[model samples]
Target chain A: MKLHFSTTHEDHRIALLAALAISIYIIESAFPSPLPGIKPGLANVITLFTFLCYGWKIALQVSLLRVIISSLLLGTFLSPTFLLSLSGSLLSLGILMLVHSLFYPHYLRQYQPSAIGYAILASVSHISGQFIVAWYFFIPHPELFKLLPILMTFAVILGIVSGIITQHLINKLCSTHNK
Target chain B: MFTIGNILFKTTDFLILLSVSSLIIWLYSIFWSTDTLYGQAETLQVQYYNQVAIDYPLDTDRIIKVEGSLGSSIIEIKQGKARFIHSSCRNQFCVFHGWLNIVGDSTACLPNRVSIRLKGTLNPYDAIAGSQ
Candidate 1:
């Protein structure tokens, strides 16, 4: 006898968003990177959009699925690259959750972080987490920290670009929903 | 919301932007600026097995071979950078480390028992360990 599987709307949404992130990740990986940690991180546009629009539970689900599925698809599952991606995703989601909690109250609405703010925080935490893990496990050398500034420079720039794209997507999403 | 290029950037966004920029600049000043550790590296010290280390000035360009347990490792210094040109070790990690130009930077060929370190007037280990 075959066991029946059931799914919900939330599951479907998570799957769809994760698919988008994974496709972007695969395409991004196709390009040769000049440095190890520097990338456009265009896939982050989806994550930031999900966190800014959807609640934390859904955002976390989508982001985790994205990292895990994408690594498996790329054959990097359980490798150092996979570990770095997992750590980066976890830290980014953690920071976004914290930011949303702190800034989402009605009184705090004026200080609410826009997509750009969330994207920058996510990008910084993601790279910081990956860098720390890399230094600890692989290199464990002081000289490795020297690359942090350069990696962070890329993170900030890419974060802003992803943020703008995310804001635009959210705007388009809102208009269609209202209609 | 602050509008630039039709994007809704808010106060907190600018605040985060400023903070991250300053942090990156601060790290750059500490690590990548011209006057930091790389500027002070004046000597390359090579050690072979249990032998006393020999200091080579960075001003001159030359090649040196140090006898190791496995075999001799070839080293070259040119234009203020030092690197292992060849090593008998299979991994070639020391050679792969590329260049050593920072005052505290060091690399060792573990299998061959040869090591190289960049040094300056001030001993960083002495400063860190408080006695050396």
Candidate 2:
């Protein structure tokens, strides 16, 4: 099957992808909240769609470039906070990509459930990465593990919400007529 | 190969339940304990070393004192708030942390072996329990 991008032209498609990623990052970051880290991670939806539509290489590129640009644009460049955010994004993307490749085709009919499952897992991975880095550098303590369960509860709730949203958008965008 | 994602998803529901329960447990533990268990005031030690040396039995509400010899610094606190306001350490990160109020709030100058910390808890266990 010829991907839609072949007809859309290379430059236009690239621009579209970049715009989508930047928009996702900006929208997620702008919200002021008491919640420690509750980004919808809308950019992952773009990453997943691109992975399914184009290829893993492009998806990886999109995730990496988006994170780097977002960090620089957000004025967190080269800081530990930027590194923590990058690590979470990369870990989440890696988990999503792996899940998509192996179980996605087999569980196509259960896309919503699959999305939820993947979202929860990705959230855990992201949180774990951040916690590890934070514990090692910022707040060092073995007792810090006590904080994990509280964090996990929030991650599950937010993961389900983000996953449902992502799936809804993906289905709408990936429909035969929409593309 | 089963990735961490697979293991996590398989247990996501269970883990969420467990986390909720544990959070309740932690909260209960915090509120119900009769003794006030403080986090070690090591961090507060650094801030103490930056100011002038002080003697014991403090009586002021807000006092800041820093004291240290050539290689030893000690910040003594006798009141409500204290901090590692400054330090001669190489990094000087402790000096930047400023004031802290929590019991055992401290910063240390490792080179000087000096530590500063906020001393007492305003709401001690007896007061918290309304026994006093």
Query: Model 2: per-residue lDDT, tens digit, A122-158?
Result: 7767777777787888789756665665666676676
Q: Model 2, B11-125: lDDT tens per residue?
A: 4434443554475467447643333345322222233334664433334543444455544332434343455545556776556666555554445566655655445534222
In DockQ terms, which candidate is top?
1
**How many Å off is the CA of B11 in candidate 1?**
1.3
Candidate 1 lDDT, tens digit per residue, B1-132?
668776788888989999999999999989876445445778999998789999999999999989899999999999988999999999999999899877777888999999998888755552222221
Candidate 2's TM-score on the B chain:
0.38
Candidate 2 error regions (>4 Å): A1-14, A52-55, A101-113, A175-179, B1-132
Q: Report the error of model 1 at residue A79, Å.
A: 0.7
In candidate 1 the C-alpha lDDT for residue A129 amounts to 88
Docking level for model 1:
medium
TM-score of structure candidate 1: 0.69
Considering the two chains of model 2, state its CAPRI-style docking category.
incorrect
The DockQ scores of all candidates, in the order shown, are 0.54, 0.04
